[model samples]
Target chain A: MTSPVLTVENLAKRFPTGRSGVFVNAVNGVDLTIAPGETLGMVGESGSGKSTIGRAVLRLTEPTEGKIIFDGRDITKIPEGQMRPLRRDMQMVFQDPWSALNPRMRIGDLIAEPMKLHLGLSKSERENKTVDLANRVHLRPEFLRRHSSDLSGGQLQRVCIARAIATNPKLIVLDEPTSSLDLSVRAEILDLLNEIREQTHAAMLFISHDLGTVKLISDRIVVLYLGSVVESARTDELFSNPAHPYSQSLLSAHLPADPAAKLERHVLKGEIPSPINLPSGCTFRTRCPVAKDFCEHEVPKPHHIGSAEHQANCLRIPDGGNRIAQTETA
Target chain B: MSLLEVENLRTHFISRDIDNQIRVAKALNDVSFRLEAGKVLGFVGETGAGKSLTAQSICGLLRPPARIVGGSVLFDGQDLIEMPQEELNALRGDQIAMVVQNPRTSLDPLTRIGDQLVRIHQAHTGGPVTASRGRALDMMQAVGIPDPANRSNAWPHELSGGMAQRVLIAMALMNNPKLLIADEPTTGLDVTVQAQILDLMKGLTERFGMAMIIITHDLGIVAHYSDEIAVMFAGTIVESGPVREVFAKPDHPYTRSLIASTPEKLQIGGGAKLGGQPPDLYNLPSGCPLRTRCTFAEDVCATPPTRKQIGGGHYSVCHFSGALPEGGGPQ
Candidate 1:
């Protein structure tokens, strides 16, 4: 088998509340991998540890445990000083364009900063590259001189993309890149991201709460719940036949354009429990429709379903649910 | 009579420079719309598409440097644009309230959540603080906020993003306003929370027999919730109609493109493509602002077009009003 570009195993992160309270386990044992040129999507609700996992992979926040192997190198325990060079290969695009950027810096310098820092380019070379990156993202070169405050939300996002791509990174973690943008501009940004991937063959860890967008861009999908990977499969397979009860509920809640599609809106009775005070067994057992008494005693392991490539963290799949019938039916 | 009528509403920002540039954005250029007592009008458009401006104008909250240049804002048989400042202020929270997108920014960071709620109620209804607090607590409960009494005293930062937005809605409904302007209230919210908030807004609007102006860029959202929808492009209402009629058959090129671009409608992996950047508002094109990006632009488009009625309560401002391409061709 070909080696994956980025690999993560049982990754976890915990933050000290510092108030004598229990520590907050932001990310709890998430295992994922992305091959070269693959767009892997991580979908979850707020406080589901999706962003925490992304940060852990980048080593931005210190991880409490687990392994992060990037391109044959185990980077989990690497010092911050040595990790600087590795950052050149892995870049991140933040969600909020407004706060992510420095308002005082001009757009040209913002995009050029990455080039100057990592690429060792001269002044004129950096300027030319900045304009080139802007053009790629459909931002006019003339606007590079403008400050972040002057540009609108869509323009600022384009500038953010230009900065992320400036370093020619192999894997870019897109953290809700288009969520803040309006629909018309969002389509444009999605197109630009696809174009960049096609042109550069760079992998992407596309994290978003938007299912529609994830289904469009991601080759494969990972469903997270309360800090655990409940399911992972090919995008089409996962959307068509979601195995986990939480996945089913999430998909059912999505409002499709067609009014005739009978989507049973399952309103989970209780609110999502705090990450600090997670339920004893199966993290999703609280909300899962098919959760049983045994589910409360034992955490579900990743049971292989559909094909060897597909897996789901649900005991119901193995307990006479007819996994073959459900997985193949879609 | 229509419950609300806005005629030739134009909000312009006066330039601070000595040149007296008078940067008249014409945010609402001769825009006209009517809403009945219990109708939901959805304003669907991209950023700087004048949807926000139109909402803020209706609320009479356009900040300094930006003022109503020429228009008549009639609400419930009263002309709001010409009303005195104090009278308008009284009518604002009493008759018209807005639920903004970011509750954190809209809410006062310094004040306790409960205190802010009480203040809005007292200012609008002139009620006692204790009585207002009781009402505020009830309102918060109605919006599905858990433990309203305890949570009310919590600071804005203590609440999650979804919880903060619910608080904003609670404040907006303090006086049971006749019209509620929800300006992308669920834009930043998660889908599940978004669905909950949207349901709450819809239920509250119906329960109070209030007219709602839901400003959003998501077509699916507008289609699901709005009875009427107005598609804006470059400070102009290109198309306005009943939501079903507009979605079934969009007349304006921009509106058609906007609807087609929605991912849910398109085949998977074949998302609709909208070309290039949105035109700069400062240096707008000669005639149709969308001509640059529009696929069916003609010489007549540069001559400007006017709204033409296509059906029941449906209007499109296009030279090719009924001549829009089938299945969104070429654009």
Candidate 2:
């Protein structure tokens, strides 16, 4: 297999609260690796620290501990000056395209800014590439002259994609890129992302709370709970037979768009606990429907389910007690 | 008789621009629907589609610059539109309760959760404080908030997003309302918490036999939760019917596109005919609002399309309703 484009080891990030010595444990020792041209989907609820991992991987936020190897380089602690050139190989697309882009600049200039800063291309070459990139993202050439405020949400996102691909980065982190869009518009954006992935062969860290979207686009999946990895597996294996209790519950909770689909719901009670004072042992034990007494004190190690690639962090897996009995709601 | 009947409802945003020219945004045009007790009606639409406006018009919640120009909202055989503000005020919180998005902002930051529930109950029911307090605790428990006795005293800021949403639902139930309107109630919540809250609300609605209208952008929630569904476009409901029938055989072009766009049904680069600018409410098209974005628009579509009934209680407002060839749009 080709070398992994991005590998994270024991990555952790904690934000200091108002009270001295108190910190919000956003990400806790998350270890993951994304192979070149592969899409790694990160699924979690709010306060799950999925976005933190994305930001920390790109060094947008400083990590408190652990390592990030991008394209075989340990750039976790690299200085900003040294990281500047490496930035060309890593790109990020945020949730809100409106705020991520500048209102003053024209659409063409916005798409061309990255190339100008990194590629050292002449004016004519940059202009030609900007037009080509616009067409690549299915954006009209006429829209290049218009300002961002004049474009719709879907068009603006296409512009953002155009900018991200302008650098042809090896690693791209997309944090809920389609969450803000309408249903139909979201499908279009997903299609564009899929096409770009096939053409550019860029490894992607697709972080989203929507299971359906993640399942549609990802080659592999990682489930996070309270800043920790709970399960990781191939997309089909994870969706068909999720081993972790949290993963099972989360998948059951997702209501499919089709009314005919049978709903076997295992509705979890209560919300995720505060990140500041996370529950000890299994962070998800508080809400896990099948949690046991041992789950209170002992953090479950990753237990491979069936295949080496499919693993879940749940102690009950050995005894076949991880599956929560789901009630048929349909 | 239906618990609520909204007929030919129209709401307009009449404002003056910087040039002092009067601009009227026909936000809600000829919208109509009905709801019986113990039933859930889902309003599904994109942003600026007048789903919330329909709810506001039903409850007489329209503010300045947004006026109800036409139509009647009848609740329990009485027209809410013609009713005086004093009478409407008494009926709003007591008989018709509403739970909106952003649970944190909807709450009164200064008041404790329990006290807020009690205050709302007292304002509507005019009971003794002790009884109100007792009912407040019962409601908190009813909505599945743990440790209601102590959690009641917790401030709004102390509660999490899901907890705050539960408190809002509890507040809406304090008076045993006949109709509940939840506008994007679970928009910002996680899927797990959203399931819990939706289950709680469904249980409450069945127990109390309260008619509910859940306005949301998520089709998944509507598909599973609602008995009937209404698909809205630029200020108009283009389709309405039983949820199962609508999902099984959608007659409107817009409805077809919406269903085809779902992650389960969508095939990448399969020509789903998705993505177009939302209709400009300020300068809406002459007839069909969706004509600009629709793939099968023809010269005849410039004229207004009349509602056609495809089956029992299944209606689609399009000139070519039920006649369009399957999967024959622009590819």
Candidate 1 CAPRI classification by DockQ = acceptable
Two-chain DockQ for model 2 = 0.83
lDDT of 2 by residue, B1-331 (tens): 8998989999999999999999999999999989998899999988889999999989888897999999988999999999999999899889999999999999999999989998998888986899999999999999999999999999999998999999999999999999999999999899999999999999998899998999998899999989999999999999999999999988888888888888888887787454688888988998788898888899989999999999999999999988988655432
Q: Put down candidate 1 lDDT per residue, B1-331, tens digits, no spaces.
A: 7889999788776665568555645556677898998899999888777899998888778898778888798999899888889999998877888888888998889999999989989898985789999999999998999999899999998888889999999998888888989998998777767877887888888788989999987776787777899988888888999877887887888877676667765443254466656677667788888888877888987977887999998999988888765666433
How high is the CA lDDT of each candidate model?
0.84, 0.93
List residue ranges in candidate 2 displaced over 4 A: B326-331
What lDDT does candidate 2 reach at residue B153? 93
Q: Where's the lowest-lDDT run of ten residues in candidate 1 chain A?
A: A321-330
Give the alpha carbon lDDT tens digit for every residue of A172-212 in model 1: 99999988887766777887888899998999999999898
Over A111-177, each residue of candidate 2 has an lDDT whose tens digit, in order, gives: 9999999999999999999999999999999999999999988899999999999999999999999
For model 1, the stretches where C-alpha displacement exceeds 4 angstroms are: A80-85, A96-168, A257-262, A285-297, A315-330, B18-21, B107-138, B147-157, B265-272, B329-331
- Residue pairs that clash (backbone atoms under 3 angstroms), model 2: none
